[model samples]
Target: MINQNKKTYFKERISSKKYGVLMKKIIIVAIFCFFIISKFTPIHGQQEKIPVLMYHHLENNLNSNVVISPENFEDQIRTLKEEGYNSISSQQLYDFLNYNIKLPENPVLITFYDGYLSNYELAYPILKKYGMHAEIFVITSRILEKNEKNSYLNEIPKMNWNQLRAMQDFITIQSHTWDSHYKLVSNNGVKNAALYGPGYINNNFEEQLQYEERVKNDLILSRKLIKEKLGYEPIAISYPFGIKSEDTIELSKVAGFKMGYVIENKKIIKGDNLFSLSRITVNGNETGDELIKRLKS
Candidate 1:
């Protein structure tokens, strides 16, 4: 009787220890799953806003709406520095969006569009002085044509391949599209230029297939040319005129672009679509204070 009683007690104790081990394993797995789920779960009231600022020309052409004077541009750069705004790279922004990478306490992005010579001549030095950086979106068709010694659109001068390569450290060169910088009118009466919109002097309508084909070809050619000339594939494109359609957005992704920037929406928040990002457009007219106000989080 004593032996049997001792055996029963040992069996119960061993079973209890085994049950405790199983409970511990289940608790550990539950904690790990909760941690993973928490990463994707929405926080009650917290959303991060990343501001992307847009600028066109940095030259002193008062008659031109897009041209900003060097003095004013320098002032803007100084203001950003004084305000403790950290100018981050496009890839950093992409990583932050896609990987939840942490940025500075006050993060911002400066973007220059259209591959202007003034960006190298005027803006680069100012940015350097401020210890800042910017992403320059080039109309690849213009750069390629200029390189080929062919006539450019509107006789506008753009940064050549040599200039771009020389200033690559401070400026990230991306595509603004190879040749789809024009407008195309739809089969209906609507007209827009970023992706498609502009019939003719007579406002004729464009066929759907023709518009899609144009977008695809332009994006593919742009990606190919940039890879061939720049030796690295561009990852983003600032929509021409900050205008883009659903079709154009998808085409951008298909052409290997990870992010496509639009003109409006003042601020970029945490959950904004990577394919269609928005920026704050700063014209040459706004004062440095106005630009800062526009960038408010």
Candidate 2:
């Protein structure tokens, strides 16, 4: 009887040990699953960083730092589509930044600095094919009144108003400025952006008030021209050469621009300065894979 009691005690002890081991394994698995859920799930209050890509021109054979070839542009656009990046409009961005509205997953903005004819002839079709949205900040003074064919293969042409209107389905037209895209040489021969300078030009010093008035006027005119032609007010301005003075934001606000963009080569996040938003300047030399890596970086 004593021997039987000993055997039964030993069996119960062994079973308890086995049960403890199973419980430990279950607890470890639960902890691992919790860690994975926390890692992959979106937090309630997390803000998203949006990448804004800036392109200047597109051409068939021309290759330059600012000019991307048509093939490369299409490749880039196609890759973006494959990567699940959704293109958002400026208004959507503004609403998201200001009103705390939720944006679509993997939101990005594709922008062009100048309204080049190639944007219409080459880039527009690819963008449309991929069902992406983009914006072009046109120098209002450079837009031709009517569409015209390019006669010279070597000529770098600007998009006309008709072309601009035609691409409105896929492209948003914004402002580069009416005529403030030029640079002024100061008395010391140091050049300054016309919109940002109150410095000496042609040996004459422009007063601060004079500089403010000049910039304000140009901004107003650019806004006016866009509204008149496009039937909507422009809410953003791309600083010429991405240069601006200390008062640039205030001046833009007074002239009715809701936001400003710069070529600072950074992604924009919520709570970023609205007036000096950042953009990634895309060059012809970057491959589609490189661009995807850049966006991830």
Candidate 3:
């Protein structure tokens, strides 16, 4: 009886040790798989974000807060390429925001406001050289039939319709506004963006109906003109001076825009407001490296 009991104890102990070893191996394998899967696969329900860059004039000698030099612009684009960023189109961005479509690795957006001729003369070529695409928002009233042949020293020239058509392959044109880029002072002499409303016009405060009428008309006209000239309606509009109100957002939808961009100085993430999306302004003074650092942040 004593011999039999000893055998039983020894067998139970060995079995316990073997089970422990198996559990440890299983746990280690699970941890390794978790690491590999997290690194290699896109996890569902994780927040995905992309940077949208807003650029203005590209000038040779004029490097202001908004006017980037051609050399620096090229550097920025080159750095973006090296960093594995792909410039997604405006429509792609919309689909990603709405449909949860998988975006390319490290997707970014390049956009220009005010539709300066330098966009065609300078930025367009650089973008084409890099095989990148961009969007330009034009003020409809400022677009002329032909280039003014003017100098950036006096007044930075606006892009002509011909120039706009020429760059259509690389540059997508959208609406800035018709004629609402200026400020409208209220009866109390407090000035604000024209889209802000309650403006002092015709020696009287603009009624709510009147303000709505003016803004809707301007946006509709902008959309209509782009469709007429470019053969397609624009789906997006960047507010003048990045100014917009709740009313403006609803008005934008009424104006037939699918998306509206604002200057919030941040990247846009999934589940954000489709209207009032954020854009990071690329500072002209910053080097390409600095710009990359900012983007990483």
TM agreement with the true structure for every prediction: 0.79, 0.81, 0.83
lDDT computed for candidate 1? 0.79
Off by over 4 Å in 2: 1-46, 148-155, 187-189, 200-202
Number of residue pairs clashing in candidate 3, backbone atoms closer than 3 angstroms, sequence gap of 3 or more or interchain: 0
Off by over 4 Å in 1: 1-44, 61-65, 144-150, 197-207
Q: How much lDDT does candidate 3 score?
A: 0.87
Stretches > 4 Å off in candidate 3: 1-46, 148-154
**Backbone clashes, each candidate:** 5, 0, 0
* TM-score, cand. 2: 0.81
Q: Write the per-residue lDDT of candidate 3 for residues 23-140, one digit (tens) a residue.
A: 9999999999999878645578566678999999998866767999999899999889888889988899999889866789889999998878889889999999988889999988
Q: Identify the superior model by TM-score, candidate 2 or candidate 3.
A: 3
Candidate with maximal TM-score: 3
